[model samples]
Target: MLMTERRAVVTGGCKGIGAAIATRLEADGLSVVRADLPAAAGAWRAGGGTAVDVDVSDTRSVDAMIAAAVGLLGGLDVMVNNAGVAEQRARVDAMPDSDWDRVISVNLGGAFRCTRAAFDHLRASGHGAVVSLSSTWGLGGVPGYAAYCASKAGIIGLTRAMAADGGPFNIRVNAVSPGYVANDMGGSLDGLDAEAAARAWAGRDLQASFQPLGRQCDVAEIAAAVSFLVSDQASFVTGTVLPVDGGQSNRLNTGEQQWPAP
Candidate 1:
């Protein structure tokens, strides 16, 4: 069976990679429910996915969102742990405990909450899959992104642990680590309209110069990978950090080499 046919819930599904995951899942024939911040309902529904206002970090909201999604889709086969919050750039020395906690709560705690809430529905369905969104920055150092890095890195660890826990029940857990995607948090493009950001990344082609792919990846590509990981086709796959990045994580995009001096 393809992805769209499955009943899936994607948190943070109103925009960016979360939206892309929900869209791709829908394309694959899966009924999709998108749990996003309240303001995103109109946009989520407009895309043919059911939208619910949810703060994945909150236990009550997480429970409600999962229940609502199960109600809307008739049961759950997949849960994409894609909702996340990133902290502002700050020196590690100066980063507040609140900042660290906030990042941890949303990125790591949200995944825990959502997965916990959806466990029964997923297990009963027999092919329960959980795919989380992670970042290459989580694997390595990026100046000014200490808190963000810690949170995402924690996700990778959590994914592995979940895989072990869910294996007995036949639920597979995996994560996708994205690098240099043209999004507000992922690349040089911040606060720009999505179209402009896409154009700039594709037009500039800086991703390959250092990333090995020489291009920024669109959200769809990563979503497709996530979809595959959750699909039956990957039945044997579990407890992996699948890097959707074009090897950029291996070679940090340091700077342009000025071989030709002025």
Candidate 2:
């Protein structure tokens, strides 16, 4: 069947990497639904795509959102679990329970909820695919981001597990682990003052120096990676975490190196 006949859902799809993924999927001829937080509904400026508000952390919200999306699209073929959050830097001992819980609930739990709610729709589609967003921190732990790291890492494990379960139904499940991306969540200083913005760029420069690519990733690049995984090109691929990081996953940080804020 033509990709134009397929349907997709991208959580947190109003901005950043999620927006990029949604756009790429739509460009590839898939009918896309951009699901995000209720407050972010107005942030979707793109046309020709359905936008839905969903708090992935809430079971009722996720279930209802999936129902609505399926009702709009008639069925679901791809599920992109991209809604996630990161808390500020803090030592594990100093990290508040609220921070840990919220991050896990939104990041890890959100992915699970979305996938579960959409599993049936995807299975019914006969050729289903799931792509979740992980992070470089999920692969190599970073200082002061225990909750974020753990949640992302859990995504990898969940992706593999889901892949195994979906194998019998021709459903593929995978993850994309992105390193530093030039986005608002990745330290972009869009609203920051001159000094803060400079500092942010300086930090990116320093990190880029250590990274083999000598630069951060573009949201479009990450979107492309996801695009392939959900397409027929990766029909044989499943249960893998594709690192969209610029070889950052291969580079090792020295124990004494100063780390970025979480």
In TM-score terms, candidate 1 sits at 0.87
Candidate 2 lDDT over residue span 123-237, tens digit each? 9999999999999889867899999999999999999999999999999999999988888773437678999998987887678557767688999999999999999999999
Clashing pairs in 2: none
Tens digits of per-residue lDDT for model 1 on 95-205? 899988888999999999999999998899888999998888899888887888988998999999999999998999999999877564433477678998788766546
lDDT of every predicted structure (CA atoms) = 0.85, 0.90
TM-scores, one per candidate:
0.87, 0.92
Model 2 — which ten-residue stretch has the worst lDDT? 41-50
